[model samples]
Target chain A: DTAVSQTPKYLVTQMGNDKSIKCEQNLGHDTMYWYKQDSKKFLKIMFSYNNKELIINETVPNRFSPKSPDKAHLNLHINSLELGDSAVYFCASSQRNIREAKNIQYFGAGTRLSVL
Target chain B: TQLLEQSPQFLSIQEGENLTVYCNSSSVFSSLQWYRQEPGEGPVLLVTVVTGGEVKKLKRLTFQFGDARKDSSLHITAAQPGDTGLYLCASPGYSSASKIIFGSGTRLSIRP
Candidate 1:
């Protein structure tokens, strides 16, 4: 069984179009995250949800929003996508422990979004 | 802001050659993690180091944490083609809980 899975392994859209990526994890983790990996291979945290509650909101544009209906799912919606939005979007989950401060993330195969 | 800097942004070597990659940060972290990402896939955690001057080994890979808790290193012996991937080091972001900040990554290509 795949621990973490995301839909639409590849997405090709035009500029100004809106798209959404769905993610699900069966690991029963408490925390889920959305990350953007640029061409340089730098993974930047966009948003994080801990047990359906928004926790970390980075400097991402408001066009991108994350929704977690429950502990197992976290989806990302991007409106008016631009050329800069062309990158691999990854969904990850982890069993979080704030006091111990150890987070080992399990990632999905990733969705490659191309904004033309 | 805490930053993890990885050395040798890109490396290409022949199979059977050993290599070592370093992850350094000026800020102290309670723990550090190492992940390897293959093409068209997300990163997978390989190991985590918590204590200062700690070392862990997994098969052919050896992970070492600095005495100051500000640096770490990953060494692979007799690297195979399967070892070709982008290796990243990460730590909990200083600004938020459960936020992991990753290094730029080292892209390793092993040619058979």
Candidate 2:
């Protein structure tokens, strides 16, 4: 079984269009994250949700929003997408244990978004 | 802002060669993690080191966490073509509102 999965593996859209990417994890993890990988291959965390609660929102533009209906699902919505929004989006989940200081995150295959 | 600088952003080596990728940071972390990512895929966690001066081995790959927890390294011995991928190092954020911070990433290509 795929531990983590993301939908819309490839998305190509025009400028100013709206799009969304869906992610799900079956690992029973409490934390889910959204990351963006730029052309330079630099991966940056965009948002994080733990048990459906928004815990982290990086300095991303307001047009980009993340919604988590439940702990197992997190979706990203982009409004008025710009050319700069073209990049690969990755979804990951991790189980946090109080006793351990570290948690291992499992990632999905990734969704490549292109805006022209 | 916490920054993880990975050295030798790109590496191309022949099969059966050895290579080392380094990840350094100015701030100390409680733990560190290494990941390998193939084309068109998300990164896969290779190892995690929590204790200072800890070393973990996975087959031909060796991962080390610095004594101060501010740095880490990944070394692969006798690399094969299957070893080609992008290597990344990351650490959990310092604040509760922050997420994990990833390095710039090192792309390794093992040519046959």
Candidate 3:
């Protein structure tokens, strides 16, 4: 589709449960990122991967882990989730990370996660 | 960590009205970008300002980068109902792109 795509557009689970959200990009970009949008609609960066290598890891909790198997795919895995984890999680990607270029990011439709 | 403070967290205006959203920061950025996000969707990039004091226009929307590269603004002229959405600003600093920071966002509602 030449866009960033994410699966499980909605998720509902209990506390202490584990879940995973998958992401893929057909834009041929090398860098992928995961962002969490809170209830306030604030988008915050969680993790970033470049060419299947982990690059940026924000001050996120250890329970939220992001794994990249290939350049086009990045997955988010959460262990022992809490109620505060409920939010809309988005996946994005970009071409280059160069300072001069500062490549623009393309985002997915987002996965709304709800924990009870 | 760099922080982007967006002004006027919420705004409601009638159609054809004008308003501006501001993003301010204490740290300099290599490039700043503006995005508009609708309900249930991810943010869509509107513009990217690379140079300090640079100005870019997209239709009725205009974006300006601060001369210090630490702030930015998005002004809309004759706004329409379709302009209602959450506007976010992001600043990805340096070559690593690790220090990227996003503004709190401006939620604008344009009534027709």
Candidate 4:
């Protein structure tokens, strides 16, 4: 069984278009996170959800929204996409205290989004 | 978000060579994690160091935590082609911080 999974491993859309990336975790973790890695290979945290409650929202653009229907899933929606939005989006999950000391995150295969 | 600086943004070495990558930050973190990402794939956790000055080893890989808990290093012994990938360092923000700041990643390539 996959601990974490993301749909549409690759997405290509034109500018001003809207798209969504879906993520799900079967590890029964209480926390889920969305991160974006750009062409520069820099991984940045975009949002975090704890038990379906919004916890951390970085300086991400308003056009990017993360919706958690339940603890098992967290989806990302991008409206009026821009060319700069092209990047690899990754989904991760972890328990409240996933580790004894360091909370380790389990990541799913990333979804590469490309905007023209 | 805390900013992390990783050194030697890109590295290339021959088989059996040894190399080390450093991750530094001004902010203190209770723990720091190391992840390896392959092409077109998500990162996979390699190790996590919680206690300051702690050291851990996995196979030929060695990890060390700074005494101040503000930095860390990853050392690979006898590098191999299989080790080619992106290495990222991330710290689960301060206690109850809610977010993690990941270092810019170091790309390593080993020639067979």
Candidate 5:
């Protein structure tokens, strides 16, 4: 079974269009994250939710919003997407250890979003 | 900001050749992780080193953490075509939160 899965493996939309990507994890992890990988292959953490509560919000713009309905699902919605929104969006989950602050993340295949 | 810098941004070598990639940082980290990402796929964690001056081995790949906990290295012996991927080094964010800071990554291409 795939531990982490993301829907819409590919997305192509025009500028100013809004889109959403869905992600689900079966690992029973407490924390889920949304990451953006640019064309340079630089991975950056955009948002993180632990047990359906927002924990980490990076320097991402307000256009990108992450919602976690439960511990197993975290979805990302982009409003009025622009050309700079083009990148591979990845969903990951981990069993967080607050004491140690270290965890192993399992990632999905990723959704490639291209904004024209 | 705490940053992880990986050396040899791009490497293309023939199969059977050994290679070593380095991840350095000025800030100390409690632990570090290594991940490999293949084309069209998300990164998969290979190993994690926690203690200073610690070393771990996975088949042909060996990972070492610096004594100061500020650097790490990954050495692959007799790299095969299957090993071709982008290797990234990451650490927990400076804050106590569960965020991870990933390095730029080293893109390795092994030709058969």
Candidate 6:
């Protein structure tokens, strides 16, 4: 089974449109994160939820918001998307209470977002 | 500014050769993790080093954490074509609110 899964592997939408990407993890992890990989292959953390509690918000634009209905699902919503939003978005999960050594994150196949 | 700086942003080597990728940071870390990512896929965990001067091996891959806990290195011996991928080193952010912060990543290409 896929430990972490994302929907709409590829998304192509016009500028100023609204879109949402869904992510789910079956690893029973306590923490989930959203990351953006730019064209230059630089990965940056955007947000994180620990047990559905907002723990990290990395000064992302107000147009982007993350929602975690529960500990198993984290979804990203983008409103009025711009051309600059084009990039690969990844979802990852990890156990929070484990020792520092076991904090390895498992990522899902990314969703490629293209804002035309 | 990026907290971690990775050397040799890109490397192209021949099969059966050896190569090393370095990740450096001035700030200390509790643990460091290495991940390998292939095209059209997300990165997968390769190894995690928590102690200073710790070394771990995975078959042909060797990972080393610096004695100061502020840097790490990955060495591949007799690299094969299958070893070609993007290697990234990451560590937890300095603040409790910040999650994991990834380096600039090094793209390794192995030619047969």
For each of the candidates, the C-alpha root-mean-square deviation to the true structure, in angstroms, is 1.4, 1.5, 1.6, 1.6, 1.3, 1.3
* Residue B30, candidate 6: C-alpha displacement in angstroms: 2.0
State model 1's lDDT: 0.93
lDDT of 5 at A79: 97
The superposed Cα distance between candidate 4 and the true structure at residue A107, in angstroms, equals 0.9
What's the residue-level lDDT of A93 in candidate 2?
A: 94
Which model scores highest in lDDT? 5
lDDT string, candidate 2, A19-112, tens digits: 9999999989899999999999999999999889988888999999999999999999999999999999999998765433466778999999
Clashes by residue pair, model 2: none
Query: Which TM-score value belongs to model 1?
Result: 0.96
lDDT string, candidate 2, B31-105, tens digits: 888999999889998888899999999999999999999899999999999999999998865655436789999
lDDT by residue (A63-89, candidate 1, tens digit) is 999999999999999999999999999
Off by over 4 Å in 5: A99-102, B94-96
CAPRI-style docking class of model 2 based on DockQ: medium
lDDT of 5 by residue, B13-62 (tens): 99999999999999899999999999999999999898999999999999
What is the per-candidate TM-score for chain B?
A: 0.95, 0.94, 0.93, 0.94, 0.95, 0.95
Q: Which residue pairs collide in model 4, if any?
A: none
| Per-residue lDDT of candidate 6, residues A29-88 (tens digit) | 999999999999999989999989999888899999999999999999999999999999
> Higher-TM-score candidate among 3 and 6?
6
Tens-digit lDDT track of model 5 for A1-116 = 99999999999999999899999999999999999999999999999999999999989999999999999999999999999999999999998886443588999999999999
Cα lDDT tens digits for candidate 3, B10-44: 99999999999999989887789899999888899
Q: Number of the top candidate by DockQ?
A: 5
Order of candidates by DockQ, top first? 5, 1, 6, 2, 3, 4
Over A1-116, each residue of candidate 4 has an lDDT whose tens digit, in order, gives 98999988999999999999999999989999999998999998899999999988989999999999999999999999999999999999988664435577889889999999
Candidate that beats the other on lDDT, 1 or 3, i.e. the better one: 1
Please give the C-alpha DockQ score of model 6: 0.64
The TM-scores, one per candidate, come to: 0.96, 0.95, 0.94, 0.95, 0.97, 0.96
Q: Name the lDDT value of residue B16 in candidate 6.
A: 98
What tens-digit string does per-residue lDDT give for candidate 6 at B1-109? 7899998899999999999999999999888999999999999999989999999999999999999999999999999999988999998555544478899999999
